[model samples]
Each structure stands twice: as structure tokens, then as C-alpha cells.
Target: MHNLNAIVVGAGMGGLTAGIALQQAGYTVELYDRVKQLRPAGAAISLWSNGVKVLNRLGLGKAVADIGGQMDRMAYYSSTGETLTEFSLQPLIQDVGQRPYPMARTDLQALLLNRFGAEHLRLDSTCVGIEQDEHSVTAIFEDGHRATGDVLIAADGTRSRLRSEVLGAPIERNYVGYVNWNGLVDAREDLAPKDSWVTYVGDHKRASIMPIGGDRFYFFFDVPLPKGTASQPDLYREELSQFFKGWASPVQLLIQRLDPQTTNRIEIHDIDPLPRLIRGRVALIGDAAHGTAPDLGQGGCQAMEDALVLTNYLQTTNISVEDALSRYQTARLDRVADIIKRARKRSDVTHGKNPETTKQWYANLKHEDGRDIMSAIAHTILSGPLN
Candidate 1:
């Protein structure tokens, strides 16, 4: 019999979502993070219909809807401010049974953390090592304490130590030859239209603007950079201004208002898709399993879906730990791998250096009924494993 205890190795979206699903699946789950407090470190996260579907299973869909901003449409434009294509999000909203919302990444984290009280979560507890045998797993902490559980879930993100232990060396974090900047600007009444999201594409760069809450819009910029380039913190804002000099309207205004401290610059990275996501009593979830560029906004959603299905597998099957882990891997690998591939391809097509070709591609997608495409993808997610 598989024991009903689990240790989750990170407090980010994947870890907390896993804890919730496992605990509710009759497991006693203890979640840990190295950070003293779990505040929102990044800008905003889009709760695509798939993400909200998992949230609905948790009974927090309404809470997410309450705090998140809804958009009826998404429009794409050229850097010269010419409209290229547009699509309605209404069909996707109806298919998921909930409207897609853009909530401040911090706000969503706070809402998820409240589901499990502080007692189940240990802040500032760093997991340094994981030891496992045929039956149980033990986690070694940096503070000189050890805790054992039936299973250890490594959601510790891209630089996972548990991953290193399982694979026997540090896996290289591959950069995509681009860096992204993101921040949430204070809601300016005169700026961005309400209830709509916009993305503007330029040669070798892309910018996204979307509402996250009542007044705030989440903005992201992905700019091309040479591989292995280090960015200077002190000159980020000035560098950004110079990098995007004389782009589009509103975007120029938005960039002008950003506080240097609030903006974050990260080199986009992805791990080559793994052949498997589990090893004995330890299984990897989220980015640890498959990290990819954010071009598709499916990273968090895919992780939440993994957590849900993993819990379902463990609860429904009277199988050994290895069997359960294997089942989880079986259920997730292909779907996630396909997504990773699609996301990489989409990034290439979206930010293609040849502006004319990129424009032609977007035009073709626009004319092909994007709502139908979204519906098909949604069906794949909701019906694939959970059904």
C-alpha cells in the first residue's frame, strides 16, 4: 500500500497546487520553500481556460474570477501600430465554463496559499538533498533537519537539486537567445482600453499588454540578445528605453512609467523535453519536468493539470508507488511534450525576424477561426486524462 504522505519541495504555483491536490487526495502533504515569505516575485500570470479548469476542480474558480481581470478579445498589431489580426476569447470562455482571467501573479499565489494554512507550509526551509529507497523518501534540509515521507515531489523549479540527485549532475539550463522584461504598471485611467489585451510584435522582439486587475495591466517585453549575455541591473530601465526607442504609442507611455526596481529581466530558458518525469518515490512536476519559453502562456496551466491528474492517479489506483509514478508519467509526458514543441514553434513564428513572413502567418491563423483551435485544445486538456 502506498503511504498517504508527501513532501513538496517548492512553494511556487506548481508546489502549492500539488500540495492541495495531494492533501485532498487523502495524503498528508508538507510544502517547503527556501524563501522566508511567499510573495509574488514576478509580474502577472494569465489563467488560460485550462488553468482555470484545474482551479475549478479546487473550488477556487470563483475566487480567481473575483480578483482577476477578464478580457473578451486579444488583438495583435505590428510595431508600427497597424492592426494585423484579432480574435474573440468568448468561445474559449464558454468552453472552459469560466471566463479567462489575468490576475496579478502575486494575488493568485496568495489565494492558493490560503487553501492550506501556515501549519502545513514551512517558510525558509531549504531542501538540500533527497534520499529514497524502495519504500519511502527522506528530504535533508539546509538547517540540519530531515523529514521523511512516502513520496517527495520535486517542484523546485529549473535549478532543482532533487533533479540533480536523480539525474546525477546539473542539467544545463538552455537559453533561447532572448531575454524578457515584465512589470505591472499602476493603472492609468487614460492608458489601455478596459477588458482587452494587446500584443505588438516587432522584428526580433515582442510586447504584450494585458489587464491583471481593476486598473493594472501586465506588460511583457521579449528582446533578442546574444547567448550568455549578462544584463546590468543599474542600467535596465535606461537600456530598455534605448532598446525600444520610438516603437508604438501607449507602449512607449507604459515603458516610461515603469519603476526600475519593479521590472524584472530574465533570460528565457528551456530544458530539452525529458523522456520521463519520475524516478522511484520521487516525481518531478512543473518546470522541473518540462520548462519552456512563455510564448504560449501554458507553463503554469500545464503544471496545475499535472498535479490534478497525479493526485487522481494515486487516489484511484490501488498500485505500488512505482506504478503510480509510472502512471503519472504515462499520463503527462506526451501532452506536455507536444505543448513544449508547439510553444517553441509558436515563438519562432510569432517573433520571426522576417516581419513580412510573420505577418502572413498571423493573417493565416486569424482567418482560420482561432476559436475553433482553442476549442480543440481545450477538449484535449479536459478529456485526455481526467475523463
Candidate 2:
């Protein structure tokens, strides 16, 4: 084992993953989070094949598999409830050698948090700034406490305070031209297949529900909307009902069944790729490194990949900490930027930013076989460092 200790800011998925990976590499890991109790930002995350691969490497494969949704089929419908296409995801799984797990964010978080061990993680500690010298780095907290380590990792998320310090300016997030309302509900066949992911598309909007663990389904409604749209507490049901009016039965049922009070209403946003992800011994990962629209459901997956890659460099290279971070940046920058750009373009097309393109996409959906879609997914999974 190398003689190194690490400080991780943020207890989100990426940070926890990083902590676990680094610990397995025999590094002392201290994790800090701003929240008193961890609450997931969204309802669920679609852990793609690539993401699952990372978890498997971290030795949490069976635990995650047991807690994740068994999503093996995907279907799409038109506004009038006509089936566009339906196909089993088995082919993709076979091709990629791993299955995608669509699980509740809460469960995923708990699993990672447990694996990382809560004893080593500090809560309700907000990171204010950092100071690094030639030999070590120190994280300053809002409460005037400091934790110094061999290296500092800013997995603090998209609006990371440390991001500003590393980049020399605060980067603004670009709105993806849509309002998303998401929540979880008990899985019922009337709402959607218990094991299938279903989506209804029309009018520059979509209502989707995917099966998750614990006999429940994770659901979301997406509608094109202007930025800074005003929202009120417990208004999700009424707002989604109005926006998704005249849609299919499953879509209506999803909107009706999901609780308004617990639902999360968010305006989607993604940042342009950063010029770099490392500054000396301080490195960025997850959303801080490459925030992307969730159109392709790769946000969490990419973050997991970041943790794995960063850990790999730090453990395997036998290089200086700074050099390891620089190698990680070189390994990650281009790939994550490409995924972010693709997700942005897909978001634009889905939300009617290009009306013609959106129309064409809707038309093409009717003729789409599950092959092309699965092929595309397979290509992405294969492209990740896990392969």
C-alpha cells in the first residue's frame, strides 16, 4: 500500500464511490458532505451496463443487483396510446456482458454509503475553500475547521464551490429547455409493466415510468418550458396533469399515482465541458468535472466511471499524486465531453429545440426496431474504460 491519505468533498454518488475505491487501494479516505442527512436529488438513476461494471469492480456487484430494478424490456407509445415499438433488452445485455439496473436513488445511495462506511464520513460540514502546498492539500470548512490530506478531490457536485477555485471562475450551467417532475410509486401493471420500462411521447413532452426495486416504479414527466419557471410546493400533480393532458392511460395514471408532495420538480441543465479536470493535487469528478443533461441517462454512470478511472491511475501507476491526476484528466476529458455533447444534442431534439429534427425523430420511432437502439447502447457500454 502506498502512503497516501485523501480528502473527499461531497457525499454524493461520485464521492462515495471515490472513497470506497481509494480505500480499497489502501488509501485513508475522509468524506465530508454539506447535508445533515443525505437526500437524493432525483427519484432514481438508470445504472447502465457501464455503471454496473464499475460497481462490480468495487465488489458491490451482488448487493446492487439485488437492490436494482429488473428492467429487461423497453417500450414506447404515441400520444394516442398506439405502441411505437417494444423490445427486450436481452440482446444488449448479451452484447455488453452486463445488464442495466434502474434503481431508486435512495437505495443506491444507501448501498454506497454503507459500503463507504458512515463512520468515516462527516455530515453537515460545508466546504468553504481549500489550501494546498507542495506536499499536501487542506480543505477548509464553513465552520472554520480544516482537514488536510495527501490530495483533495472536489466531487462536490455541479455547483461545487471548489470548482470556482480550480477553474478561476464560477461556471454557469446551461438550461436544457425543459422542466422535469420525477417521483416513485408502487409498481402496477396498469401504470406500466412490472418489469418493463415504458414511455409516452408527444407534443414536445414525454411521460416515462421504469420499474425499480422493492416492487415500485420510478416515474418522470418532461415538458419543454422556459427557464426560471415558477413553482409552488405540492403543485406537481396539478402541473403535470395540465402539461400531460390528453396523453395515454399509463401516462395519466403515472401522473395521478405519484405523490405531489414527495415529487421533485427541476429545470434540467448541463454545463459545457471544462477545459481541464485537474489542478495540481486537486481534481474534479462527476458533475463537477463534466455535468451533462440526463437525456441518455449517463450522468451517474459517467460519474462512477470517473471514480474508477481516478482510482486506477492513483493505484496502478506508482506515479506522483500530481502526475496521476494529470493522467486521469488526459484519460477522461475527451470521452466525457463527447458524452455530454451527445446528451445535449439528444435533449435538444427531444424538447423540440429543432422542431424539424424532433418531428423526424417522432416519425422514426414508429419504425425503429429495438436493434438500433440496443446497438447504440451496446456501443456506449463497450467504449467505457471497463471494457
Candidate 3:
């Protein structure tokens, strides 16, 4: 076992995965979160092959498969109910050697917490500041308490307070000029194909539904809107109805069947790629380092990749801690930067911000087999460190 103790801030997917990987690597791990009760920040996460490979390495493969949705096909449709394209996911699944899991965020969080052991987690401990010396790093909390460790990892998310101190300035998040409302609803075959991940798109708007475990569907509605628009939770159903009005029957029915109480509404925002990801003995991971838009569905998957790669560096190298962290930064920076850029472009195209590009994409889908799409996805998955 390595004679090292590590402190991880935030109990999100990235932090929990980090804590788990480090613990398995023989580092004593301590985790803290700002929330009094642990809850998911979003409705669900699309755990692609790359992310699943990490989870399998962490010894959670069967458990994840049991709780994740079985997605067999993917289909895209026009808002008027015309089928734009449809394809089986088997080719991609066979290429990657694993199926993607669209698991509910809450279930995934619970699975991580259960595997990591709840006792190691400290809740309601909001981190306020961090300080490190030649030998150790200390995290200061809002409750006037402190914890010291061999290294500190700030997985405190996109609005990471520690990131500002590391970078010597506050970084602003760029809003993509849109809002996303998401939730889970009980699966009804009448509303959507229960075994397929389906998307309906038109008029700079999109609505998607994917099967999740527990006989339910995870759904999202995305539309262009001014930043900082207040979310009217009470009017969720009505608001969605208006935005998707006159769309296909599936969309109309899905909105009508949604329960407002279980829905979440928020403006989408992401940070510009940082020039660096480490400082002293502290390193940033996940959204703290490279928060990207969800258009690529790689945000959570990348975080999982970060945890595994960071752990691999620390375990395989005999170098100093600082050197290991610097290597991690070098290994991660460019890859995450590319993902951020791709996600932003995808967001623009999906939202109809570039009409010509959007039209071309829709047109191309008509004649193309699923080969190009699957190849792109396979490339992204194969590019990960584990593969």
C-alpha cells in the first residue's frame, strides 16, 4: 500500500469514482460534499462504452448492467413524425465490446455511494478554501473545520471555488443560449419505443427519450432561450406543452404525461478549457477541469475517464506526487479540450444556430448507413486510456 492519504471535495460522480479508484489503489481516501443529502444534479447520464470500461475496472460491472437500461436501437425523427433515420446499435456495441447504459443519475450515485461505503463520506461540508505546504494540502470548510492530506483533489464541480485560487482568477462559464428541462417518466409503449433511444428534432428544438432501468424513460427538452431565465417549476408541464405544441404525437403525449414535481429546469452552461489542471499538490478533475455542454453526452463519461487516468498515473509512476499530477494534466488537457470544442459545435448544430449546417446534417443522415456515426463513436471510446 502507498503511504498516502487523499482528500476529495464534492461527492458527485467524478469525486466518488476518484475516491473508489484511489482506495483500490491503496491510498486512504476521504470524501466531502456540500450538500446535506446526496442527490443527483441531473436526471440521468448516458454512460458510454468508455465510461463503462472504467466502472468495470472498479469492480462494478455486473451491478451497473443490472441497473442500466438496455438500449438496442437509436432513431431520429422530424418534428412532424417523419422518420429521418434509424439504425441498430448492435454494430457499435460489438465494436466497443460493451453497451451504453442510460442510467438515472440518482441510481448511479447510490450505486457509487454503496460501493464506496457511506461512512467515508462527509456531508454538508462546503469547502471554502484550500492551502498546501511542501508536504501536505489542507481543505478549509465553511464550518470552521479543516482536513489535511498528502494531496487534495477539487472535484467540486464547474463552479469550483478552488479552481479560482489555483488559476489566480475567477473563470466565467459560457452560456450556450439555451435551456434544458429534463425528467424521468414511467415508460409507456404508446409514447415511445421502449427499447430504443429516440430523438425528435425541428425548429431549433429537440426532445429525446431513452429507456432507463426500472421500467421508465429518461426524457429531455432543449430549446434556445436567453440565459438566466428563471425556471418555473410549477409550470413545467404547461411550458413544455407550449414549446412542443403541434409537434409529433409522441412528444405531445410525453409532455402531457410528465409530472412537474419530478422535473428539473436549468440553463445550460460550460467553462472554457483551462490552460492547466493542476497546481502544487492539488489537482482539478471532472467538471472543475473541463466542463462541457451535454450535446455529445460525454460530460459524465469524461469525468469517469479522468478518475481512471488520474489513478493510473499515480499508481504506475514512481515519480513524486507533483510529477504524477503534472503528467496527468499533460495527458488530459488536450483530449478534454477537443471534447469541449466538439460538444459546443454539436450544441450549435442541434439547436439550429447554423441553419445551413443543420440542414446538411439532416440531409446526410438520409443516405448514410449507421457506419459513419458508429465509427465516430467508436473512435471516441477507443481513444480513452483504458482501451
| Candidate that would win on lDDT | 2
* Candidate 2 collision pairs: none
Write one digit per residue (lDDT tens) for candidate 1, span 14-120: 89899888877778998998889887657888877778778889888788888788688777777767776677877776666667788888888888899866688
Please estimate how well model 3 matches the true structure, expressed as its whole-model Cα lDDT. Answer: 0.90
Clashes of 3: 0
lDDT, each prediction? 0.79, 0.90, 0.90
Model 1: colliding residue pairs? none
After superposition, candidate 1 runs with Cα above 4 Å error: 1-3, 353-359, 362-387
TM-score of each: 0.92, 0.98, 0.98
Q: Where's the lowest-lDDT run of ten residues in candidate 3?
A: 225-234
TM-score of 1: 0.92
Q: Write the per-residue lDDT of candidate 3 for residues 1-387, one digit (tens) a residue.
A: 276899999899999999999999999999999999998898999899999999999999999998899899988888988988889999999998999999999999999999998999999999999988888899999999899998888999988988997798999999986899999999989878889999998888899999999999999999898877666778888888889889999999999888888888878898888999999889999999998999889988999999988888888887677888888999999999989988898889888788888888878867767888889889888888877
Residue 247 displacement (Å), model 2: 0.8
Residue-wise lDDT of candidate 2 within 1-387, one digit each (tens)? 296899999988899999999999999999999999989889999999999999999999999999999998999998879999999999999999999999999999999999999999999999998888888999999999899998898999888888988888899999989988888999999988898999888888888999989999999889999899899847777888788788887888777788888888889999999998988889999998888999989989999999999989988776589999999999999989989999999888888998899899899998998998888788778889998
2 or 3, greater by lDDT? 2
**All models, RMSD in angstroms:** 2.4, 1.0, 1.1
Ranking by TM-score: 2, 3, 1
